[model samples]
Target: MNEPQAIAGVPLRWVGPLRIGGNVATAEVEVPLATYETPLWPSVGRGAKISMLVERGIVATLVDERMTRSVLVTAGDAQTAYLAALEVDARLDELREVVRACGRFTELIGFRHEVTGNLLFLRFEFSTGDASGHNMATLAADALLTRILETIPGISYGSISGNYCTDKKATAINGILGRGKNVVTEILVPREVVRDVLHTSARAIAELNVRKNLIGTLLAGGIRSANAHYANMLLGFYLATGQDAANIIEGSQGVTVAEDRDGDLYFSCTLPNLIVGTVGNGKGLDFVEENLRRLGCREAREPGENARRLAVVAAATVLCGELSLLAAQTNPGELMRAHVQLERKNATTKLGG
Candidate 1:
């Protein structure tokens, strides 16, 4: 065995002149994805082409955004814990001041708590600008914990992260309360487009989505998710753009809604936990920084704006791939055939590209 230092390279390709229309951004932009699934490029490209043909091409709306960190403390008993929780709730203004003292781009958005026996879990949420709020929320939580211990008596510190923050885990709380950028991407495909581009009817895709995505997932005990391979697209985009790729664990917890509107097809993906940022630890690499810059996430803008745009684009990318995959599955053998075809090329090729 030999210890060596080198950067790992994955096959990268820019897919989609994806047309996006929404509050955050409106443009036809090229998206870069790095993955071994070569079929994904064309799959997403098919959806992107449909986007351009449609009217409201991938209407990506950024609904809500926040980063959370929870701290655990102990009290004498449940009664003592209840009183202390209320007391802390009353002095939220004071806690905000504590956060302001240390954080410039992070804003305290208040908190929620869960008390069990003598243990108290205080989950603090914040609006972290531009950068993902993992480190930033932890830093502010550290300051808040000190003030809390000093002000409120009989409450002792347990751990800074009580797992209530639920970072990178596929918990239902993050799906409901949201841990990162919450983006919903949708596109309306005309009957002709569905027939021409997808070679399937809106009825077929919508029925397949219900039977396979919803019921099949429920049968398999999937939590807060109803989609095909959201992780595949998230990983490709995250790896290409320098995100904490593990966040996809929770980020993949999303829903795919499909409906046949008379004859047209309305498809949407609601991703509540899209944990990505333009400026972060992994973003400093030469290729990563360049990719971010090219993706228009590196521009000078208002705090949190760049990250929001990035999140919107990322959500739209997921939609493109998800829509394509689901549509392909409407017809039997298309999905596996395409995957085998592409993977065979990747295997035979010299570089696994």
Candidate 2:
């Protein structure tokens, strides 16, 4: 057993419970330590989870490493935070639609509100079970910010652009694209569904397929390289909208798993870092309207956040379909054999076997 190693260097720490792959790993570390110098107001006794990825022999690989960034927002009291949280929730609803179109609709968890100066930083958690939901979530966050700005006259807003969005287009926008805090969107899906049909190598899962053909000339790397395939969600989304294609990087990641349940098989896809806004950017692109229509959503009036929700759903839909195809391929004969056996047994029993 690998004993718990100290988490490098950190002073303030929080010890609590964590669930990994349903396995309880009780370890003590820091409780929302100051990754940045900004003031924080996280609650006590709330649920939290820490995820790490390993490749080759290295124990801690960030897939992509990111430094801490901070922003300032202010909310007068808990009621203000709660109200901002509701606006954030409505924006997330838009994100859900996007992922749903691409994969199966599961559930979403995580919601927080932070205050900096006079600005209010709203955050939420989204789960894109099968498909990548990065672009979907990022856009949703942006839309939420826009909504807040429209409603609240006195409050200004900014975002913490570290792991989520730091690309050229994102830079053009104000602050960053995430929820202006240490935001994380974790995905969970069953693994039994996507084993033999698709490549499971770690390198392959990270590649972004959607951007390979469109960005500049054909790039040397393929979508299956190091969390690159996540770009597909962004590519499809950007083409539909007029978004700066670069911001997609701030909110993109992909993960896959295979599971065996008794005699059955299942598969899952997890996408985190979906950064988006509700009312601002990318609501008027011609193709965006078309894509929204395909997903049974209206493109008119504040479609930014709605677009984000739909994008996540679409990614989930894609994932679910991919898993279905793989599952069918692995067990081609089982469906037929099971039916035939059942019929024969019924016939024999009818004759008083």
Best-matching candidate per lDDT: 1
Clashes of each: 0, 88
Go through the candidates in order and give the C-alpha RMSD of each one to the true structure. Answer: 2.3, 22.2
lDDT of 2 by residue, 4-59 (tens): 47432222222122222211111222222211211111111121221111011101
Q: Which lDDT tens digits does candidate 1 get at residues 178-267?
A: 999999998889999999999899999999999999999999999899999999999999999999999999999999999999989999
RMSD of 2: 22.2
lDDT of 1: 0.92
List where candidate 2 sits over 4 angstroms from the true fold: 1-69, 72-228, 276-279, 299-305, 317-353
What TM-scores do the predictions have?
0.97, 0.32
Q: Please report how far candidate 2 places residue 328 from its true position, in Å.
A: 13
